[model samples]
Target: MIISVLAAAVAPGAALLAYFYLKDRYAPEPISMVIRMFLAGALVVFPVMVLQRAVVLAFGENPFLFSFVYSAGVEEFFKWFLLYFLIYKHVEFDEPYDGIVYAVAVSLGFATVENVIYSLLDYKSFSQLLFRAFLPVSGHALFGVVMGFYMGKAKFHTGRPLGLLAVSLAFPVFYHGLYDYILIELKRYWIWLIVPLMVFLWARSLWKVNHANSRSPLRAVYSEDEVKLPT
Candidate 1:
């Protein structure tokens, strides 16, 4: 029973990670590095939860503060810090799309562990598991996409590296804050708003993935002759 619940909890993150992993079609990151980042992300959950508990105790759970500051702000900032310091300069991070690959790896790693805890505690039903899979797990992956898109640009392109890196961190925090805000504050209308938010997130994430792939220095270049009429 526990094993089944754990498997269900882990499946979504693994599926999402695999999806993003395949997106790096041209040059996939080393399996070892991806696993390393994933484990690092999982390890941070302990400290993050501790800090969140301290913050909640201090602030007494103001909805706005809880969603934006305690949850999104703390979570994303740590992720950004980890991605920047740990993976950004590694030899394996050689292309634009590599950013998305690794960032999603870390984000899903965190999400998988969180899901397991939730499953063991509150969300035992099948419907609840489905809800958690599509929303919380998928949400983390989308946020990672936003963060990685900008990080990739900051890494490869010379224009405005600092600014782009700043955006990498800032944008995910804003999106995540808004996402949590809808769930925490909207009460009855959260369902309506959340669907549209997820739609927008999926669209934006797809664009980011494609755009990052396009910017890869390893991307294939076509010659005019290669495109000339076959006749």
Candidate 2:
């Protein structure tokens, strides 16, 4: 049972990691760096938990505010903070797609650990496992994809890095807040709202992945190299 629960916890996050890793068609990041980022993301969870607990104590049990401020705002802030400070300036983060790769790595890492804890502590049945894998786990991946899309633009576009950075954090927070709000505050039939939202998020994330890949400067460089090769 322990092994099964562990596998269930990790399955969603691992699947998402593979999906985003494959999206980097031009140049894949080093596995070591990705692993390190994943671990760092997991480590951040502990501090975030402490902070969230304090927020809960201060704010009481307002579900709407908690979903927006504490859950979405705090969690996304830490994830973005880590990405910006730790990985943004790295030499390997040259291409735009690298942003998506690393961001998804970090997000899924956090999601994996969170999922394990929730599964072990709260989950009572197979249905709960399936629901969490689809909603919370996959939702984190989608948020990472959106955040990374703007972050990639910020790194490569050079026209409006600050604006893109803002979007990177703000966009995810808005959607994440809405996601939790539906389930937390609205309740009942409102939970169905997340279905369309998830569909939209998935579509948008896929488009962003394609856009980032198409705009990769490395692709052009590789093309130039191929042109100079002996025929």
Best by TM-score: 2
Inter-residue clash pairs, candidate 1: none
Count of clashing residue pairs in every prediction: 0, 0
Stretches of model 1 off by over 4 angstroms after superposition: 221-231
Score candidate 1 by lDDT: 0.90
User: How accurate locally, in lDDT, is each candidate?
Assistant: 0.90, 0.90
Q: What would the TM-scores of all predictions be? A: 0.94, 0.95
Over all chains combined, what TM-score does candidate 2 have? 0.95
lDDT of 1 by residue, 98-181 (tens): 889888988988889999988999864889999999999999999999999889989987765999999999999999999999
- Ten-residue segment with the worst summed lDDT in candidate 2? 183-192
lDDT of 2: 0.90
Local error of candidate 2 at residue 43 (angstroms): 0.9
